[model samples]
Target: MKVKCPTCQNEVEWKPENKYKPFCSERCRLIDLGEWASESHVIKGESFNQQLTPQIDEFSEDLPPADEDFFKH
Candidate 1:
């Protein structure tokens, strides 16, 4: 089957051999990545980013120190 590239609307073949499936070329894939990196693409809804960061830091601090036995397991 064939599908249009999400970035450039070029036709692309849907196949296992096509590494950049859904994109016509590497250029189109990278362009999509750039859009994501620049925050040009965002999901609409509630954001948990602000709430989870401090919880992660707190959890990491609570972890026990690693010793030689840690690797043996």
Candidate 2:
């Protein structure tokens, strides 16, 4: 199947034996990877809530105190 290059938009023929697959060559493939690594290609998804809710019980003030005696020894 023939397809246009996503970067340069040049029409290129696709071959199954080509390791790069859709991309015409290694350079084009690397350019695509670089874009992804640099976050130029964004994955669209649902947005998470900005406010973080505490998982632990608010009333429980039972955290163990740090041992300063260990360092002193």
Q: Which candidate wins on TM-score? A: 1
lDDT of 2 by residue, 1-73 (tens): 7898775577778887876657776556545643544355421111111221243222122312342232234
- Residues 30-63, candidate 1: write the lDDT tens digits: 5565355445532112232233343333322232
* Clashes within 3 Å, all models in order: 0, 0
Worst lDDT run of 10 residues, candidate 1, spans 42-51
TM per model? 0.52, 0.47
Q: Which portions of model 2 miss their true places by more than 4 Å?
A: 40-73
In angstroms, what RMSD does candidate 1 have relative to the true structure? 13.4
- Candidates' lDDT values, in order? 0.54, 0.46
Give the runs in model 1 whose Cα sits over 4 Å from its true position.
Answer: 40-73
